[model samples]
Target: MSRLRTHYPLRATILEGRFFQLSENEILHSISLEYTSELTRLHSAYSIPEPDHPRPEISSPSFRIYGTEYDEVNRTLVGVLALRWIHFNDYESFVGCQPNSVKLRPQSFNWICNIYRKTIKSNEDLFTLITSTVINDLGKAPSLTTDYAKLTGTDINKVNHDMILYQVIHHPAVAETLVPSLTKVSSEHKHDLSLGIKLGAEFNFGQLAQAENVPACLSGLKTDLKNNPRAFEMRFMEQLLDIAGAAGHTDYTCARKLVEPIFDSYKNVYDVAIDIISGNLGLREGYDIILIRRVELLQRVGWKRAESLNIRDKEKRALMRLLCIGGAASIKTADLYYQTFTAVNLSRTVYEGLVEGLNVDGSLEQPAVQPTYLPAMCGLAIANTANGTTGEKMKALTALLTYLSRVLVIDKDSLSFKRLPEGVIVVERDLRQTIQPILESAAFKHKPDILTDAPMPRDQVAKMADGYEWSFTAISI
Candidate 1:
């Protein structure tokens, strides 16, 4: 177990937005059989349907509708669902009351309600409901004052406040920030991995523990990885410890340091790829084909809006053309100097490399994280350059992890808001002052080809011509 940071955390998806009471069918359709069974059991026991994702120990879960908000990211109608807890006694009234006024709660309540009394805090100590039967004397009377969460036998409100603070920190999005990634090997160096480090969402240990099911149908992880000293459990423990350390729940750095030898000793996927990659990565060795293949790979993952480019523009335009074709929105041209297409593309190959890298899907507002540039570049740059100096190595190490274990919390309301490497260009920026002239020259260079028998948007083209400049530097034909 790791050292306690502030308080024991019980995390669940905290939803916020207007919510219509989902029909029985709607609710049942969304959840799994096990979840449906649990809900049924809870309704029978307390009349309240158990929360789909319950916050542990806090019973009688319910929700309230306030108003509606637009989901700009999802580009669809969406509603927020806030999690509410009804006290033990409020269960009967809560269940009996109409949906309209059911949002209200009991007046005389335990101090545990203090967690909900205030706006959740972003950072602080922890306080949770701790019911103790023992009686305490508060000057005038000997009474029950221990039902609410307490700290040092004093300041119950602060204790309650701390509990709210705990909720904020424990929120998956917030929790992800607390943890940092480790200095792991590069994707290029470790070739056999299928997916890079998952750093986008909350850590669901139960989901990861299911890695036991990842091995082939006939083989268990124990039998498959017999060649390695550390078994599946050991590898999982390392992963768990890394997650815990990054979430700032514990200081697993020392523990990680202790196992440095074992980690370094493990043979990775990249070890087997040395012979194969050496010849394939030489000068002018079908690099153009590689770019096409990368674009194909991008298309495989949903980036389909690609414009073909001739080899004449191949040297300066491959990546930028890919970027241009992919709709580089909010992309700093300086960051993507089109001059160094080959070097940049090579880096992409090295980064996305032999193993596929994880990319959070792209959107109009924020861009998807650069697929492999940040993570792979960081490790290779450090390993190749910073050999003797400890300080340099540590700096490089931190940078490497930042790229791998980078987690960005996304609103789960819609698929559009998810972070994945989406190849489609949502927002296209016209950085090319050259495009208008190119279009103008192409439009008028030779007689309007009007290859299509049907009418073209000549009116729209005329309107565009009024606003922009035109040049005929070179004829299209």
Candidate 2:
């Protein structure tokens, strides 16, 4: 068994309250006197033994008396005078304790009064004041009490007592300069000091926890979802779908494993559609409604990433729309452009699916095809129509009409087919008949001069054809 050591406790003595009702200047002088008496006693009680060297050999002041200097007596006297003046003015306003009798004026006197009232009210308030004061004073000059508190936990009692301890531990002159007229209560208020130490330790612990990984460890617990397999599956599916849509590889086995179960679980019409579109398990040979729905679902997840694929461009998109419009008529050549057509059509479908999923307004609209590309498609149609069209004359007419029609759209007024001496008549006639509907369209409605009886210039027509071919080839490549 261990025996606890007993320590002798210091007794507290209260100064007389005569200065309480005095004028502000008188009050300050009395308070200074009381502080001086307390300081004298503190200095004697905690005095260090005389050094082996002579008294004159000491470079700095050794004694702090009455919370003032012992060596620099003149400066201490001047500070005491200043404190008296401040107290005189502070005491005058509180003559009667009536409501609103004492109006607080801006100065050090009001600060003193505010501190007094708050410290007397609650322990938390006192702790806050002591902590703030020590931190503030330490910021200006180092204090041993504050340094000790920083290292080992310590509590501060009333503001006055805390201030006194602060001065005793640090030098009196420095403490006065940093926090004027502050002092700590005697050992009777040790409980207040202990309370402060506990609070301070807690505050420091919080800061340390944040600085280290303790908080991070706690946060990881919230975000880590190891128990939920469904969420894991969803995230995994999202990754695989993104890679597959990006044309990464033919690793359909991995994708099939994830998608098959989701399909079975949902078992909706849309889920079937997604399976068909993803090629996890192809349904009917041609593209169907289910395939379109799958594409729509993928689009709903990530449109920007999906759009980066080369197959999801304008020509493919237009062909998909044509299939949707023409149905079986467009399905015959589905295999020829299946990859390209499927990507475009699915992208559009995905976009619409996402918009619907999110309940956003406005339907997904298809982008318009440029007018210039129309002539090339028309030429293909014409070529297919010809029965054994083998003459150089027929080939020349087709090439000439294609060029002239493109130029007519780009430079309507410069239709000069006469530059070609051979077969100029057939080219001119074909241009007029082939472009008739285009000329009547809303795009050309505003340009009435283009449709008039103006024959194209021979030299200008040749130049425009050259420009048209360069642009067309550049776009194709």
In candidate 2, what are the lDDT values of residues 1-477, reduced to their tens digit? 011111111111112222223433332333334344332322322211222423322121122223432322222222222222333443342211212322222342344334345333444333222223222112211243444344444422212222334333344344433333244533333333333322222111111111110111111112222233222222222222222111101111111111221222222322332343344433222123322433343354443322332223444333333222211112222322233333343345434432222111111121111122233323332333224233322332233333333332322133332223221111111233345444434433333223333343212111111112211111110
User: Each model's TM-score?
Assistant: 0.17, 0.17
lDDT of 1 by residue, 138-209 (tens): 100111112212322322221111122222223344322321110121232122111111110111122112
Q: Give me candidate 1's TM-score against the actual structure.
A: 0.17
What C-alpha lDDT do the candidate models reach, one value each? 0.22, 0.27
Of the candidates shown, which would achieve the greatest TM-score relative to the real structure?
2
Candidate 2 lowest-lDDT run of ten: 1-10
How far does residue 12 in candidate 1 sit from its true spot (Å)? Answer: 14
Q: Which parts of model 1 have CA positions greater than 4 angstroms off?
A: 1-66, 70-477
What global local distance difference test value does model 2 have? 0.27
